[model samples]
Target: MSSALVRNPGDGTNFRYYTNVIEQVVSNAETGGLATVTRSIARPDQAPPLHTHSREDESWIILSGRVRFWVGSTSLDECDVHEAEPGAFVYGPRSVPHTYQAITSTAELLIICNPGAIEGYFHEAGAADTRSDASHSLMEEYGFVIHGNPPPAPQTY
Candidate 1:
């Protein structure tokens, strides 16, 4: 049995991953592994490496600024780039290589993952004492396959 959970703004577990601020709004433990939601404020330099999730599907709701995403069916080299503005929503299915870069000065996004385990990776990788090498291993341990670096940001931004 589950009860209702309410989290006020800025009332969740917060951490910094690289140059981005990530807040775990709803964790897997609270939802019995159904899903997890995280809010992130990212800058252009905070773009993630091209990667694919083996265990979960991910969706993002743009809250502010703009973001450019590269999504591919199989390989990182073959991807379609899309620029999304605030109020846009993007979905990346499991095993699809994808990565995003903030195109504006700053971008705020709400990320949701199904089957809810990615938050553990976020928590571990964002830990104050975590090292770069350990962060790489944590991605693998958390079922993420790294393909390569993110694509260059669009000049139109």
Candidate 2:
């Protein structure tokens, strides 16, 4: 049995395990449940679209940099924004429509979700924009669908 939460990617294209440090980390996974902790570094122009999930609730804690998020009808801007430097925490319930954009070049955030939803979407589905129909067709079993937002631009590390 695997005791450590980290999963080594070895030489694969995926990110490294616990030692390399990832903003978005999947700490737990079971037959019907999982917990994901993400540490994300977002470029100033990077942002997700306005969308909602019917499956799981999310909680975010800003580790560094600045990020503005949309919750319901309210938008948190730079001026009146919530600064999550190191210890700040924010929770987002399911079915709430929201979007987020990075106001700074480097923004790190930790997103935690119960009964893991997005992780499966990212790992199993191959992300909506990155894969061809043949690759994504397998994900239909989990309630995955492409709705809002286009695929992210390809960048080299």
Candidate 3:
């Protein structure tokens, strides 16, 4: 990825990734700046472990369906839940803990990571290739923090 790349609507490095999420790394780390594009298709009840990136800022451009995001705030009790819809944009600053779930039957998200430091985690975790309800331990190995086992109970606002 020494040079920038253009991916047609249906092209990129696609991976089954982890449970409930499908990922595609559009721009790799070698592209410079570690700026990367990752597309995700998430199904209902598909939520990621709560974690924070140590060196990258992330943004999600909602393409379809609905996503319930827990951002910045540590606990669901902090009342930071947000429901994002198509055409919505959500930003996660570096070092901030964030997590989300697809509330609808399915959701599509375009995530951009600048100065992406965990691209390798995507490769390895995506390789583990397991789709389950358990947490992903790899996130911690990639310099991200997994808050705890089992996320806090869902809070309805």
Candidate 4:
């Protein structure tokens, strides 16, 4: 059997991503301070709260299905959300409040983070009060600002 099948890179206690967001670090980030991997089984209608990081930048590549990404005040609906499917890629810079919502029933996305440890910001984003002012405060502390409007209605595939 492949060692990959028996090894666990992220366990609940050690990693924090949207429980709904399934991810695995195919390669160790410790070696070079970055992470690269293919993540699959992402469900539709799920989204991370609006937030950003001060220390890392994330690049997302789609393997299957579609993802709607929001940048700053412009939502995917307002500013041409990049529709990525196998071979499509989107890059988000550090300190920009953004969030993604799945459009297809099951979407697979590959996420690469430079300085890998920055995922802690993602963990924190998921923890913030997306509906309250507290969320905004946290976002600001990390150099992010939430958009005034919420995400747009889901787009049918």
**TM-score top scorer:** 1
Ranking by TM-score: 1, 3, 4, 2
lDDT for each residue of candidate 2 in 53-150, tens digit (9 for 90 to 100): 66778788887776666666333221233434556677877767566655656767776776575565555434435443355454455444334552
Candidate 2: RMSD to truth: 6.9
lDDT of each candidate versus the true structure: 0.83, 0.54, 0.71, 0.58
lDDT string, candidate 4, 43-145, tens digits: 6545655556666687888878877777754354444355667678888887666677678877777777665654545556552234233545745554545
Q: Best by lDDT, which number?
A: 1
**How do the predictions measure up, each by TM-score?**
0.87, 0.62, 0.79, 0.62
Candidate 3 C-alpha error for residue 24, in Å: 2.5
RMSD value for candidate 3: 3.8
State candidate 4's TM-score: 0.62
Question: In candidate 3, residue 20 scores what lDDT?
Answer: 35
154: Cα error in model 2, Å: 20
Clashing pairs in 2: 23-38, 23-39, 24-38, 24-39, 25-37
TM-score, structure 2 vs. true = 0.62
Q: Which one wins by lDDT: 2 or 4? A: 4
Candidate number with the higher lDDT (1 or 2): 1
Q: Is candidate 1 or candidate 3 better by TM-score?
A: 1
